[model samples]
Target chain A: MDQQKLFVQIALHSWNTQIARAEKVFNSYSESEFYKQIAPGKNRIIYLYGHLAVYHDLLKETLGLDTGKYSVLSPLFLQNPDNQESEMPPVKELKAIWNEVHCDLKELFNNVAPEDWFKRHNAMTDADFEKDPSRNRLSVVLNRANHVAYHLGQVVLVKPENI
Target chain B: MDQQKLFVQIALHSWNTQIARAEKVFNSYSESEFYKQIAPGKNRIIYLYGHLAVYHDLLKETLGLDTGKYSVLSPLFLQNPDNQESEMPPVKELKAIWNEVHCDLKELFNNVAPEDWFKRHNAMTDADFEKDPSRNRLSVVLNRANHVAYHLGQVVLVKPENI
Candidate 1:
């Protein structure tokens, strides 16, 4: 395979690996420990979980992907500090939400026509078509994935030894 | 503080957070998990640990920063299968290397003369810098940070369950 194809494959594999890794981590966590911060003033696993789902929702909108009938939460769910104090769904319920979002994203990726992967959409960035479009999609997808990975690190760090 | 100063502070904070997060995850891992791939045919935690250090080494060279005395590895460490087996370091050694490189990066950030931050280096891309030095620096710094975050995410994703 050529360099571009190699990169795309690597990216897809990276995404798949992360999705499974996250499921494993979240599934293993107890409710109390999942919400605990790894360090003082650091983000907890719940925040990262919410943030990942919210980012996928934004990406769907940005890419104009049809996530039919799925009730993806708004980015505001992760914003607005006052709303953060509100009770979160039980661990199982949150996992279901995460799974649903991932399912939609997987579907979207499956349907992305290779020729259209580089197609520019005005909703995401102001850059013109003359600029490379693949770079844009790559940036968004990679950025979101990285965001999840960063938080997963946080979760692993803070998790109690006994639990 | 002006916008430039604000950006510098943000960049510094991001670098600090990433290193701390990496250290947290690094310390939690067992020896076996460090080299174990969380998923079949996927990256090991040790791969990420080494990759991050190597990437910093590359970026330092790119920006004309000191890379110390070690011979820098080629960028294609991922592609060459032969190199992969022979060059892979033990988890403990990789973590120590990451910590050392992380410190070097922190020191580099601390000593960056504000004027040097604004200085334009010839980028591989066609983006024009003569129009605004501040904008150029912002783009460069943001892009570099994203690069680091991307690899750091890989580290988190590959963490073993027991670790």
Candidate 2:
């Protein structure tokens, strides 16, 4: 494969691996387990799930793939920390949304041509992008993959093996 | 820059970003906090630091950069889980080891040519590498970056902000 294509493949593979790992962690948790904190006073599994979903939904928008569908989650998952007085969306509903958002993203991501990933996304101004082209769509995916891995480590703490 | 160099830059950027984040988290913890669990029964901060150091040390070997100097850490950090009967290295020694390993890796990584990163490393057999070229030196770095991010998240739970 050409260098550009190979780079794209590596980036996508990294992203998918982390996403799959996150899904496996999320799936292992019972609904009751979702209520458990990653640590004594850290974010709960449900909150992390919702936070990831919201960020991914925004990732789609950043890639110019799709406008995010989970805007309602912003206040609860994005703008605030866990254990607020505000009630979270039901676990069942959040789970469904998580699957739906990722499914759509996976398809969209696969279709993007390797060179297209180098283009500036919606989040950045063209002037800034011109100054530093390194802040491209692929960079966002790379960073988000790390973000997922970070939380995956935390949420796994709630599982039986960790304790 | 050529496509190959750009790809190398991106991979190295991802690796370096995670390393810096992990360092920041490690540096933030007081000596006492190193004994705290990420969760109720999860790995402690000190263990995670040693674990990361050992893995990065091994990464040097995998990349054919250097034979690992920190083999002594393997019994405590790599071979056993936290809270074992085995005594841990002091926090000061682990901290120094962590910095030394990463400093050497950073210099070595910078010196490697872009195309060289796509070459197979010592861990893989030639036939297997021919079949699956994706398991190259760069892939190991990418994977290890995520690994660091994972532990970084867990360790950050020890911070006052997260708690």
DockQ of 1: 0.08
Per-candidate clashes come to: 0, 0
lDDT of 2 by residue, A14-36 (tens): 99999998988799888998888
In Å, residue A157's CA in model 1 sits off its true spot by 1.1
Cα misplacement distance, residue B104 of candidate 2 (Å): 0.4
TM-score for candidate 2 = 0.96
TM agreement with the true structure for every prediction: 0.50, 0.96
* C-alpha lDDT of all candidate models, in order: 0.56, 0.87
lDDT of 1 by residue, A1-163 (tens): 3323333443454456656777788777788876775444445677667666666656776666764332344433455421436676666777777788788888888787644544555355556644533334544454455566655655555544311
Q: Please identify model 1 stretches exceeding 4 Å from their true place.
A: A1-6, A67-72, A81-84, A125-127, A132-134, A160-163, B1-147, B150-163
Candidate 2's C-alpha runs over 4 A off are none
lDDT value for model 2: 0.87
Candidate 1 chain B minimal-lDDT segment of 10 residues:
B75-84
